[model samples]
Target chain A: MNKQSLVYTVIFTFIVSFVFVTLLALANDGTKERVQLNQELNRQRAILNALNIDYNGPQDVQDKFQNVEQIERDGVTLYRTTVDGETIYAKEFTGSGLWGLIRGYLAVTANMDRTIGIEILSHNETPGLGGRIDEPWFKQQLRNEKIVDGTIRVDGAGDGDTNHDNGQIDAITGASRTSDAMRTILSRELSTFQQILGGNS
Target chain B: MSSPGQILKENLWTNNPIFMQVLGICSALAVTNLLTNTMIMTIGVTFVTAMSNLTVSLLKGLIPRKVRMIVQTLIIAFYVIIVDILLRAYLPDISRALGPYVGLIITNCIIMGRAEAFAQSNPPLISMWDGATSGFGYMAVLLVIAFFRELLGFGTLFGIQVLPDAFVPWTIMVTAPSAFFFLGIIIWIGKSIMNREGAPA
Candidate 1:
């Protein structure tokens, strides 16, 4: 607490803080670009996954992504990522789940009757239970699932093997709430998209 | 000079932040569900921690003792915000994938603890090394947990096909609770090693 001690402490503190902040600024400069690029590509990939548009290379993916334009139909925003002048995929989205938000994209065929794929863009819920919605197995169920006749099915069930037009996808075990949430969100979004498409036509 | 072996021993075994002091548990539990995400997060935490420690150590002298904590928080927040922006702009997918967890890194006790405990006392050079080492310690534990999660839970590594098609995922390993269990075991193993090495038990 003496004057000399105080000055020493003050000087030491000043030097330390200055050096720390300066070094941080420098390090930040180094890794900034790589982190940013990685994140952007990840998002684009998710968007593509939502659209079910496959690509062999980054350039091919980017080109396909560019062709697909995002359109807002009614209240839902759909990301349309196309390839070869045809509407390869359309993403209809909605959110719901236990204890947090779950945002899902239903990737539908151009005609909108069948699902090419689906992906969860974001979700926050109980980690073990509600969060399993992002698993690939859970996600895979939506692939090739149809949206016909107002009802969705999983495992190609209840249609006597002839119900190709019926929408269905297998639900993850113990994730019933999350599965139901996805179903509800997708159904609502698709219904809205149908209405919007109707209005536009 | 201290041998590189000593540094490795210290970081990988003794003085581990996650297993020993149990710092950064919030993120440890969150991202450990996926090896790829865990690796990305670990690297992010490592960069932030090492740079922040170096910065704090450098400024340890000038910062008024009364305001030192606030100063540290400000510096940490600034780096985190920068990280968040970079993630948003560049690694939009992982950024989106990481969701709130990235921002939550600001609150991770491990980063703040190192800035206060080690950085405030050490020289910048040593502080940088310590920070990086400790961050790796945290990463090491989480990655082990994530390895199990991705392997058993998803039957993959870094999203690559690892398990044969005949393999069925455990399903439970990919959740947050699994992280908790694995982290507990890691902490136990780390502490036992430290104790066996004659470090303070």
Candidate 2:
């Protein structure tokens, strides 16, 4: 009955793993619905913000989102809504950031000529530096931004306040690498977005 | 066995994980830009540390010597996943803000270090107390670091602007390297104070 015996070791490891993992599974099951609901709300919120739709809170976000239609085609999901007689298409995008993957919603007009806005759903960038991508000012810059030369530029150099023009946005100070990553992410996503939605135009 | 007060004092000052052993600095830096994020992340770490310690202590007698590390790891990971699920469900925004850092708790050495150093030898309840105090020690330093980073970098505390409109933020304060400066200063102050008390930890 030695605790160090190989047979005991194998049985002990299996039991311990089973117990801990089962506990985790139970916790996961208990919260799965709530988590999924949170995710759905968050996604809806991001789409709303990117399209410059105002929502008060959770209930309002849910209410406002009802008008928006969900479209799944060409292996992608797009949220379609009309704002002020303008047809807007919003889609979730995943791209590389400075530290890890950055996921967000990119909303553009029907003609795909201008951005309705963009809201970062999640990112692993430094909280104060690169993470500023989610701040009011940064996302504001993307609102009604003009997409030039078939891409949006996230590399404005401390430019004087020229938001929504020249197709350039300022890189967050002290976060140039992350800014560069955003530039790449935006341009690439914009192209893919065009390819996916272009046929409809 | 050390009294609860002694354990608390030792962990908070003399044997602080951040200031003394300097463990768990990566998360300390990553989540410290904002006080709220720091608070939540630290609390999550505290919960993980305490629960894992209690479980490890309870299981120590039965754990196989050759597989102890893996068992301890599974225990830690189990708790981390639960924390993550709870955050995602109940506090979705904060969960998104935290990003992968919650999952990264599995890699934080403080949990494993406590399991091997204190939990393996201590009784279950006190070992849990020891782990919780160790987390508080880590939390104390991180909160201090977050205070300075958020204030100087954003001219705000907890998202409320305290600095005037004319005040310019120290951009570096919001970046990763700035964490090193703040953490070092805190550690230096802590050590000097400890030395003055005729006890250098």
lDDT of every model, 2 decimals: 0.72, 0.88
Top model by DockQ, which number?
2
Docking verdict class for candidate 2: medium
Native-referenced Cα lDDT, model 2: 0.88
Among residues 3 or more apart in sequence or in different chains, the pairs in candidate 2 whose N, CA or C atoms overlap within 3 Å are none
Q: lDDT, candidate 2, residue B137?
A: 94
Q: Locate the minimum summed-lDDT window of 10 residues in model 1 chain B.
A: B1-10
Backbone N/Cα/C clashes per model: 34, 0
* Candidate 2 chain A: worst-modelled 10 consecutive residues by lDDT: A154-163
Encode model 2's per-residue lDDT on A137-176: one tens digit a residue. Answer: 7877887889898898776556223667778888887789
Candidate whose TM-score is highest: 2
Q: Tens digits of per-residue lDDT for model 1 on A123-154?
A: 87655456666766667666667777644653
